[model samples]
Target: MRSRSLVVPAVLAGLLAGSVADPASAHEQVSTPSAAVVGAAPASRVTAGWTLVARYGFDGGRPTPIADESGKGHTLRLVTRNGGTVSAVRHGIGHALRFPGKCLTGRRCPHAALQSPSAPNLNPGTRPISYGAKVLLSPSQTSKGQNVVQKGYSATSSQYKLQVDGAAGRASCVLVGARPGIKLITSTVSVADGTWHTVECRRTARALTVLVDGAVRGNRAIQPGLSVANDRPLSIGGKGAYSDNDQFQGTLDDVWVRVG
Candidate 1:
């Protein structure tokens, strides 16, 4: 993977401040949206619902994939370029939704960052590895239940990694256990056709169902009894380990999140 360029001193300072300042705020005296703002323009000029939390089109040279929205919801959408990847991150300062990936190797890459107080920043890290197409979510630290849905085309790769702060394993997906033991969940799907596909994971009342493009892919009943924390922010194309330099190597679009 490549290292991203040094974030602009001002932008980095602003990002580190936990509040994103509008470019025109300091000198031009322009008003910026607060975390309460929601349902504004999308990054790709695509139309979305009024409750849109976050959206991305990957139309710029930067790595951050968050859309400039009104800041209503806590969800985020990441769009990948020809061979780019997107990631949703939650840092300690606030909620920074970003997509930092490797393209040419050893070069500094750009990533997305969104700061919001409404969401908890859990499991902070560098990046994770994703094969084919995937979506990641860091559940609310206050809630024991969680869900994630991914829809896109699948590709072939030697590495397909998904890491959760709550679990550790080699399974396609694993739920960490802050209490007792970690449970591993794996699903089989033919997602390497380079065509759009979808994968979903829903957790409620001790049951988990994995879906592919709206179709059921696998179902698992477990008593891992692992509780997902809302304080942890979700990472998509990257992991929270801050180590494994693996990043998603593909294109992604259209991401959605629903909370109970």
Candidate 2:
């Protein structure tokens, strides 16, 4: 069993491995978590057989310790840069984190993301995996590709990403196997129309399927199926502070990931 993390607070000092601490923009101080407590995250009223890895409702307006509702101890850490601010607001069941989508200087939209302190056992190999989130995009998104949630962007890196195709295209879930075997499952309709939509992606042995708004929009077959790579930390909101990466310009809530 994984050593459960405690819900204390957010600390930005040594969050990233090798990132320099900038003094240019006075970013928001990370929330202070209580401490590293034992045991899994608080058990939910209902538990599923699929085994919930981590669920971030963002109910608390504060950042750190997004509170692993799954009682799995996989607490999420906040990573904000360049005047990025994350405020907790009401959305789905309780609250959601609102990503300003614009830079504090009102110039370049930096980025805000949530990362698990340690990589959970999300590498389901050939086993069944499911991820779902409720999203609401801002009226106008400046970037073309804004990532919503991603594990590993590349194939050799061994990961998967759930991101929007372009600024205005449908959301796509991608799973990369070894070279020559990749699955880019996308939604039929666009979900970036400034509305709340539930998007889910399921990865099975033979195929990768995406269901947007409870309808099957994309179902793609996996070539050389069952390849799990990378123990990289899972990221939400954007891949990294990059232009090509899709930095989700909206509010995200009810992010749930399960593996069997």
TM-score of 1: 0.43
Estimate, for each residue in 1-260, the C-alpha lDDT of model 1 and write its tens digit: 11222121213332333322222111111121221111222112112222333333223324442433324434433322222333323332223223443334332443333232224222111111111224323222111111122211112111112322221111133433353433334444443344444443444345444445554444455443344433323434432112222333333434333322
Clash count for each candidate, listed in order shown: 32, 13
As a whole number from 0 to 100, the lDDT of residue 68 in candidate 1 is: 31
Q: Highest lDDT, which number?
A: 2
Off by over 4 Å in 2: 1-48, 61-63, 102-108, 118-120, 241-245
For candidate 1, the lDDT comes to: 0.31
* Range of the 10 consecutive residues with the lowest summed lDDT in candidate 1: 151-160
| Index of the highest-TM-score prediction | 2
Cα displacement (angstroms), candidate 2, residue 245, comes to 4.8
